[model samples]
Target: MNGSQALSITDRKADEQAMIAAHNCAVARSFHSYFNQYILTDHERGYIVIDEGDYGALPQHLMDRVVDAVPSKMIDEH
Candidate 1:
């Protein structure tokens, strides 16, 4: 669905739930170092920033999934 189109109440809530689930799953699977330094600014706009030392440890696939789960408009492509 396009970003501008308003989601139904149910759809909006479901999306919110999915994002929450995704965030929880990511945290559970991620290393403790990630949590220590990570900050979740928004479910959509912000992303987890791994410290330089831990960056390579994160699985690329998981990162991709998290990015996909986030609202497209909120992602900072730059």
Candidate 2:
């Protein structure tokens, strides 16, 4: 989706589902940091952390990384 069509997480669960559909990809939003870290191995993992956080919680750098992320043939061991 474009900037004008960007989503806001007013309702956590619903917004998350919408974001996933907008991206047309698999996404994971969790309160556990470990869950986000673990999904790094999956290419389509749209990891979002909601550990006592809301829409504006994640840093811009992380968001940038998320946007830049693309599927890769090489797997991440970390």
Q: Which candidate is the best by lDDT?
A: 1
Task: For model 2, state the Cα shift of residue 44 in Å.
Answer: 24
Clashing pairs in 2: none
**Candidate 1: residue pairs that collide:** none
Candidate 2's error at 22, in angstroms? 2.5
What does candidate 1's lDDT look like per residue over 1-78, in tens digits?
Answer: 687899899988876776566566455544433222232334464444333235544456545533432211222345
Please list the C-alpha lDDT of all candidates, in the order they appear.
Answer: 0.46, 0.38
In terms of lDDT, the poorest run of 10 residues in model 2 is 33-42
| Runs with alpha carbons beyond 4 Å of true place in candidate 2 | 1-10, 25-68, 71-78
lDDT of 2 by residue, 1-78 (tens): 766675566656765664555343322333222223211122354343232233344566455545322222233467
- TM, every model: 0.38, 0.21
Q: Considering every candidate listed, which one attains the maximal TM-score?
A: 1
